[model samples]
Target: MIDISQLNYSSADFWQQLTHLLAWEGVSDAAVTETVRNILADVKKRGDAAVVEYSCRFDRLNVSTMAELEIPLNRAQAALNNIPVVQRQALEQAAERVRRYHEHQKQDSWQYTEADGTVLGQQVTPLDRAGLYVPGGKAAYPSSVLMNALPAKVAGVKELIMVVPTPDGEVNELVLAAAAIAGVDRIFAVGGAQAVAALAYGTETIPQVDKIVGPGNIFVATAKGMVFGTVGIDMIAGPSEILVICDGKTDPDWIAMDLFSQAEHDEDAQSILVSPDADFLRRVSESIEKLLPTMERQEIITTSLNSRGALIQVADLDEAIEVANFIAAEHLELSVDDPAEMAKKIRHAGAIFMGRYTPEALGDYCAGPNHVLPTSRTARFSSPLGVYDFQKRSSLIQVSAEGAQPLGKIASVLARGESLTAHARSAEYRLKS
Candidate 1:
């Protein structure tokens, strides 16, 4: 059951309570960091041998050689035919929607010229290779495959590599099918920190990628953090989180179920509801109790909700919105009337679901938006994974004689101001003609 109070709570107290009900803090434990550091060091020193060793230790699978780790294209294709028609159709539809949405985000090279013949522009180019890590231990995430790989394909990345851990040496058929449809160039059976290391440092079988974008466990995240300079990474994702803003318009069952969606993901996952209605809070709390016993992952959800979930009774809708903004949740739902109106006021959130009908699950699977979003309040500064993750931009500038004179003078002045005589001289040289 949830604690409900209508009393005007202090901002400090509210934030403190909210922070306690979040999974962000626990993902970066000292032990986890130390373990990841050792794994990365071993990989850096031993390369393929260390990757194979860690794969055996962590995944409990024996991958003897780099050759044994690479998934055959024929096997991946065969898995597509093995899946049910309806499931394959659904995946195809999701992939199509994801591809179409990201297609719109694709950027091109552009240039603008001044009267003096100075040309300034930006040139956008897709990365040569991208690595996508799909988690396979707790559950199979075919949706993650579609979300990560489809966007890279849309961005025109030349090569797409996917990695998943399978203790039995058998990857999920649905995962392979989704990868096939999404145009993945390669698939590998390696996972954990080793998979990340193979992608970052390129084992004999796995090619080094320009960018690595996907989700995994803490070890995978730490490995990405360690290899950041060697290769680009999307973000060090934390556990999933959801924040619901309701105003008694929707059923309590719906609200409770929505909260459980994230909670069931992991014991450390967070779920919170901020509402002005005390009765609604009570109803949702009761609904959660009723719903808990029926779910297969009831224990996980109960622990998550008890430890990291909250039912905050705010004085008003404005207060609720304020709290939501401060939290910067990964998934935000406005389950009130005129959700669109409230959406306008929201400045930070990875994804926003409007009205009572749009559950977070819809966005997770078929809503066209990538589900790989920033967690741990990073919605304040970061964004969901998309086509942009697979692309890079470089500025382009060209100057004619007339354009050079004026720009050179300004550059020289600025360079001299910074006490860089060599920079000033370079600008002066451009202006000499």
Candidate 2:
């Protein structure tokens, strides 16, 4: 039997208990931060030489130059063609769906003319290049490739470069195949902080990118955090999280498995279920005990459930939503009678899976939404990765001679108030004598 924590909303210390459970220290330790800082500095200074050295040291590769690290685009296409017909078709379909969905998010440049003939608007433009880091070797996450790369492509990025670590020379064909389907322009076999540094600072072979996106280990995450100012990054994601708000109507077995889905990601991943029915929570706990032994990752699920998982008894569905808003989980499943209505009240969540039929796994795969989402309460402020992430906006302001006088006068007043004579004079020069 799993030893997951049980919380009751009526308890005076329920909030304190929940807050303690929700806490996760995601920041890198001093040693890790220092290691990342050194790697970044080395890569920035020595260029391709440093990246090659780290790749060899960390990835157990026998390469001597950065050129050997580069994976030809044709190889990705070949992987697409060589893989099982079913896998290839699935990747293509997923890519197409992701592309189609992001197409709607594309922002266009627009301008409006004022009565005084001044034009003001915004111009939307895609980044020149973007870097995607996929965990390589035994881990095959074609969905991540589709999720991160397709959005940049839909935003019309000029070039998309992907880097995956081929530890001991092992490569994942599925990731390459997905990249081909997503139209990734370049591929490199490198990983860790060195790969991030190469993408951020530019090397002899790897051109610097405007932004980097995708998941990696502690070293990679730390490197991304350090290089944030030099290049844009998706959120510094925490562990996988799923919060299910059930009205005691869904099958106990289904709810148990849903919780297990995220728990199986790793031991640190969190899975919680909130409901008004006490008996239903007991049944789900029983299901977890009964079904866990059959899973391949049972040990991982067990540790995760034992450590971070919970079954909370709330007063009602409204209270569940209130708790969810406070938690701001990365993935929220509304397994209630009126999921749509409940979703209407959800103020914060990375992704909302509505109804018992819509599971979080669907959104993770071919559900036509980017699975890259904010974690660790970041959903309170950030959003899921979309075409908007790869696109930038520039404000357009063109003042006509007649309009310049009024605008300049206003600017001059503000600049003078700030005690900047040069700024005031610069604006005043545009005003009428």
Best by TM-score: 2
C-alpha displacement of 415 in model 2, angstroms? 1.9
The residue-by-residue lDDT of candidate 1 on 145-235, one tens digit each, is: 9999998998999999999998766568899898888889998888888888888888666888988988888788888988999999999
lDDT of 1: 0.86
* Model 2: per-residue Cα lDDT over 110-223, one tens digit each: 999999999999999999999999999987699999999999999999999999999999999999899899999999999999999999999989999999999999999999
Compute the lDDT of residue 116 as modeled in candidate 2.
95
- Per-model TM against the reference: 0.95, 0.98
